[model samples]
Target chain A: MDAKTFFIYLLVMAGTTYLVRAVPFALVKEKISNPLIKSFLYYIPYAVLTAMTIPAIFTCTGSYISAALGFAAAVILSLLGQGLMTVSMLACLTVFVSELLIR
Target chain B: MHFYKKGLAAGIPIALGYLSVSFTFGIIAVSEGFSWWQAVLISMTCLTSAGQFSGIHTMLIPGAYLDMLLSQFTINIRYSFMSVSLSQKADDRLRGIWRWIFGFFITDEIFAVGVTEDSVSRSYMAGLSTLPYLGWTGGTLLGALFGSILPERIMVALSIAIYGMFVAIVVPELKKNRDVILVVAVAAAASCVMTYVPGLSRLSPGISISIASVVAALVGALIHPVREEAAEDGC
Candidate 1:
């Protein structure tokens, strides 16, 4: 895409994303009364984060072995109980460096 | 008074996270043949790691428009989850018009920090989000513009940014539960199971991560169910 087209592309994409993000805030800030819904909402981040990160561990290369090892590295470090920053960095380092050395 | 300081504090982690992740995104975009500007647009507009990744993947494939739309929605539906969570955190005093304004900047990291913030005021969350938002956009622009000129080793090191931030967040939380050995055992075992099972081994990273998180969270909540009786009036 050229400069003009790409700019427009970004504008549209950003606009769409912002709209998706912004609309719920406009519509639902006052209506949430049920405690269960509120409680469920609190857990959404954990679900989303896990969903995004764990699978990446196993499936990045369409291979079970590397992904399993990567997942193991992340889980063990995260469980052995580093902070989020440590866990992520260690996992990435382990995966990237391992791949570099092994492959 | 304290708001500005808190905002800056929150922004620091965000800026760190944004710089690393957006830089990676920039590299991915450029390597895929997109222009520097295109990369910036992706970061600025999408403001999401997975969404952008999925978008790039779709762009490479030969597919129907319906398939593209479905894929984007599936990946991005999570943002709506964040929005729902923030609705509970936002104050009743917040006006209708400004509600969406604050919500617009609610990425996963921002939502995480906001929900855990000492106060859930709109100003606090907005202030917290401002730096990360700017850093993310700016970092993407920088990465795209300078990606070629930079040495490969430097770029490689930059990829560690998000992982570093995640470590920072998880480490303290794990430490605080001070002796909640069960979480450690459960989380580790679950991670292993999620990693090795044959049927699950075929799923996408996004779904796998989601399942793992849900399992972990359930384990967490089960271990310490919400003390609704103890919840404060506003909370």
Candidate 2:
């Protein structure tokens, strides 16, 4: 991308991102009127993360084997109540090692 | 002072996370025909992983301004939802007027930290954002400068950092909270069904991800029914 064009592009993207984040607070405060709407907001994080992570685990390369290792690793590590750092390192190690062994 | 500490604490993990990922982006952007300053500017200004990823994907495709806008819109529109939800968490004071200042730095990592942290001063939240904001932008500048020199094998290993971070976030939540577990399961099921079943409107990765998340959130709220008192229990 041209230097000038790319810079402008970045500004626009940044502008939109900033607007999206700031706009909500501009209108709404702590007292949300509707309970159902408030309840739905509470669940958004878990749902968004699940949607992102699960398919990613199952659908990477190596057919069933790769998916199996990642899925097994996440479930096992989480079940063991591992901290975030530990679980991620374990998952990354499992995927890396399994990919190497399979190759 | 407390806000400063929280910002520093939150920024450490975030800075660590941004360094490798932004470095990769720097290297890739240079290779993909973006200028070094352009690479740095994009990372600094946008502070989004998927947005830049998709930006480059379409930049390679020989498109016009409209195409660029559409591509960016599709990938990054999810942040709007996150931003709106997070707005609720912001303190209603002079700091509220400065929402735009801190909101610009609202990435997936920042949002996770913001919501999880107990209610604190708005100045602190903004401070929290500033630490990562600087690291994220600064890391990309350095990475764009040094990244082109790294070997392919080493780079691939480093590329796994974001995935590693994702595991860090999700694994812990899944363990302690059944509400979190249910939400994740439902979101996954929704995404899967949407992908496989095929009658629904065609959705991009960004939209699919966002919609599934909202669906899961709505479901979790419906099922668990958070009490006002309970919200303060854990934090």
Candidate 3:
């Protein structure tokens, strides 16, 4: 894409994203009383994050083995109450070493 | 002031995580033909990993403007849910311009942290979000500038860190809450089906993720509606 087209794409994408995030905050001035809607909202974060992670995670690396090892490391570290940075770094390090070894 | 300080402290981990993840995104964006400045601009404006990744894919394929807009909207609509949920928790003092300002930074991680607070203040949310914002944009600049110089294996490994960060965020919640596990499983299954099930596999990643998350959350809500008492306990 040309520079002009790229900037337009950026603007449109950014505008759409900002509207999604901002509209809700703009409109919802009161507490939601409906249990089902409330429940759905409550579950959204977990559902969305989980959906974003899996299947995709396994395919992000050069090798599935390295990705799987990285995932495993992340899970174990998180379970042990490690912070996000620590878990991510260790997992990345694991993937780096494992990929080298596998090669 | 105290809350602002607390928010900054809490945001440190998120900022660090974002730096690494956006570093990977910067590399990908450059590889996909974005200039370093363009990648940084996208990170600064978009402030979303999945949506931007999908956007870059759409751009690389020469997709239509509507296609890009629709994809971004689909990937980002969850933030609307988060924003509405958080609006209830925000302090009454945060109104008008303040609400809109902080709302701009309401990513999944920011929303997660913000909504858990007893009462979210404008200053505190600003402090909480600003660092991650800087980290994301700054990391993009670095990655886009130096990505070609980085080793192939190192770049590949750093790419995994984004997923690792996602796993780190969700596993602890899944362990504590059966409802979370159920929702996660449902969403994951839905995602896999959309990805691998012949005809359904044709659907774009943005649409598939949007459908899976909404449908999974709906099922979870139907099966496990939160009691008023439990909702109160959460706050």
Best by lDDT: 3
lDDT of 2 by residue, B1-235 (tens): 7776767787677766676667767777877777778888777777887567556655554434565565455445555556665665665552545765666767777776776655635666666677677776777777678777876434444444444555556656666566677777888898787666676536555556666767777787788866553332211
Positional deviation of B109 in candidate 3, in angstroms?
1.9
Per-residue alpha-carbon lDDT of candidate 1 for residues B116-221, written as tens digits (9 for 90 to 100): 6545775676678778888888878877777878765445544444434433444444454432234434544565566678987765443454456556555654
Whole-model lDDT for model 2 versus the true structure?
A: 0.62
Q: Residue-wise lDDT of candidate 3 within B1-235, one digit each (tens)?
A: 8878888987887898888888889999999888999999999988997788778877765647887877788778778878887888889888788887888899878887887789989878988998999989998998899988999989888888777877887788777666777888999999998888999888777777878888888998899987774443221
Better of 1 and 2 by DockQ: 2
Off by over 4 Å in 2: A1-12, A57-90, B1-6, B27-35, B50-96, B111-119, B142-145, B193-203, B222-224, B229-235
The root-mean-square deviation over C-alpha atoms between each candidate and the true structure, in angstroms, is: 5.6, 4.2, 2.0
Query: Candidate 3, which CAPRI tier?
Result: medium
Candidate 1 residues lying further than 4 Å off, grouped into runs, are: A1-13, A31-44, A59-70, B61-65, B148-235
Ranking by lDDT: 3, 2, 1
Cα error of candidate 3 at position B158, Å: 0.9
Quote the RMSD, in angstroms, for model 1. 5.6
DockQ of each: 0.28, 0.43, 0.72
Residue B168 of model 3 has an lDDT of 80
Ordered from best to worst TM-score, the candidate numbers read 3, 2, 1
